[model samples]
Target: VQAGQRLLIEGAAGNVGRKLIQLATAAGVTVVTTSSARDFDQCQRLGSQACYDYQSGFGDQLVRDEWTFDHVIDTSGRVALATNLDLLLLGGEVTLITAPKDDQFTFGVRAFYMAQKRINGFVISHATVDQLARAAEVLNQAFSAGQLLDDQVSQQHFSDAPRCHQWLEDGQDGHQRFVLLPD
Candidate 1:
């Protein structure tokens, strides 16, 4: 993320999304993000200049607002890829951390070529151990510098892990993260 460039982050309330916001903001990039309306304030507090609800056709809204982005980092791939492709500036790129569930995606090839836009996908499970270690180190340094999020860390005993998963499945926690302490 170059200084003064603009970046849009999808799923800004997720773990990786929030980190991108913090890191990009620190790098002097303008950070705009998509999140539920309920998480807008939290996103702003993490340094997102604007937060749009992902369910509300945020990419279209941004286009209407005449906003263009240099890059996008999408964590919620299934519902976001098409719109993200539309939001890029010429020669822009998007990076996806997840794959669309149906394993199929369609886009206008002409438009993609005309804009010189590109998409990239990364699967953490497929990453080499050295890559994982480097990523860990970067995240750890960001945390130590207070440039990473630490909001709403709820703890439960290890026995409650099942319940924690259920809570996520039920969407009971908006942007909060749950930690399971050792028994």
Candidate 2:
């Protein structure tokens, strides 16, 4: 929430990305978010100072002079590492939740050194008890404030879990999140 700090969040429409936007905005950081063209309006409404369509050749539109971020969070993991590094100012930080080339040791090592960037790798399983408690508290606050009320969850009986997996694998759900219900 440092004044005048520009935070660019990649994958700004998904769950983690959306939460990042809300928290950063609440803390008074100037936030820019990237998503598909269809999700731009949603991201903007959720408190992004600006929303860019990542699929629309907008990455090239962000020249060094036009946009420089103090922090970049790559939630999508689809963007090129070089491009993300170019967007950061000196001594800036970059975080990635996913590494597409994890299996290739040489490529991963080269990519890290080439960026001249401090790269952080993350996995949800790394959340500690304290972190989980804090997340729960935030969710409670959001619910109390009516900001967490949305019909974004689709309930499926346990028997349909296999179908749900198939749907996800087939990319049929889009923004839908499925929840399983025990019969």
Candidate 3:
């Protein structure tokens, strides 16, 4: 992300989304993100230039405002794929970190080709050690710069793993992230 480019991050309250906000902001990119109303403040605190409530139909707002993004990153892959793509500027790219839950996606072939849009599916688990190392180094720099806040994380007993997953799925826990501690 180059300086002055606009980025849209979906699921900006989640773990991956928060990291993306920090990293992008540090790189001087202008970030606009979507999250639940409950986590809006958290997204702002993470350095997002603007945060919208996804549950309130942020896509509609984007359309009304006629805003576009240089790059779009989806951490949850919960939004309609076409809607995200439509908000892209010419030659913009969309990167998906997680597969959509329904395993279905659609797009306009003509629009995609005409705009020169690019789509990428990223699987972190498939990353080589070298790639992981490079990512780790960048994260380490962010940590040293006090951009990574570990204090916001909460620890839970491992037995609560299922409950944690359920909460996450339900969007019941906002702002605070939980880490399951092995018993």
Candidate 4:
């Protein structure tokens, strides 16, 4: 159990972020997430102890004021990778699902060396079938327990996939999730 472990999940409004939030909460871990201000309430409802808008300021002060997390998961590479490092307690672990590039990567490496931090790189596609099956079980339990949000999934016919993508690009569906329906 990851209970009592603090976790910082960046990009908490995205697909992985939303699922991560539910899983973390169900595990009794305290979660702190970052997203747009408009999604603050949603993130909070998803069980985040604190939610910050990544666009505002550097968010360094907020992170510093909050207790350092046991784990930091970066889903958005655009955010400050160095700051995320500073937010970890000694011996804490950081996992980058979407690794930053160029200067960002350079800085993160340097920080890891200097801080003696444990950094792990992750790719969701690399998850084993057994691992995914376990995650699915967790999700199923959460859904049954009413801990997961049922995001609206608008189904468009297979031929309408392009239109669905266009709608997503245009932000016409707000925060609703979408999927294609078999005709």
Top-lDDT candidate index: 3
Local accuracy of candidate 4 as per-residue lDDT tens digits, 63-124: 55766888888888776666777787767888888867534343456656776778788887
lDDT (Cα, tens digit) per residue for candidate 3, span 11-96: 98877888889899989999999987877787888788788888888988987877799999989878888988999999999999
Instruction: Tell me the lDDT of model 1 at 133.
Output: 97
For model 4 the local lDDT of residue 24 reads: 92
- Stretch of 10 with least lDDT, candidate 4: 102-111
> What does candidate 2 score on TM?
0.79
Cα distance off (Å), candidate 4, residue 31: 0.8
Candidate 4 CA-lDDT value = 0.80
Model 3: number of clashes? 0
TM-score of each: 0.88, 0.79, 0.86, 0.84
Q: TM-score winner between 2 and 4, please give it.
A: 4
Best by TM-score: 1
Worst 10 residues of 2 by lDDT: 102-111
- lDDT, candidate 1, 70-178, per-residue tens: 8988888746467778888999888888876657778888998999998888898899999999889888888788767577889999999999999889988866688
lDDT of 2 by residue, 24-120 (tens): 8876888998888788888888889778888866567767238878888989877776677778776667788877453332225444466555767
Which structure is stronger by lDDT: 1 or 3? 3
Q: How many residue pairs collide in each prediction?
A: 0, 0, 0, 0
lDDT of each: 0.85, 0.78, 0.87, 0.80
Which residue pairs clash within candidate 3?
none
In Å, residue 86's CA in model 4 sits off its true spot by 1.0
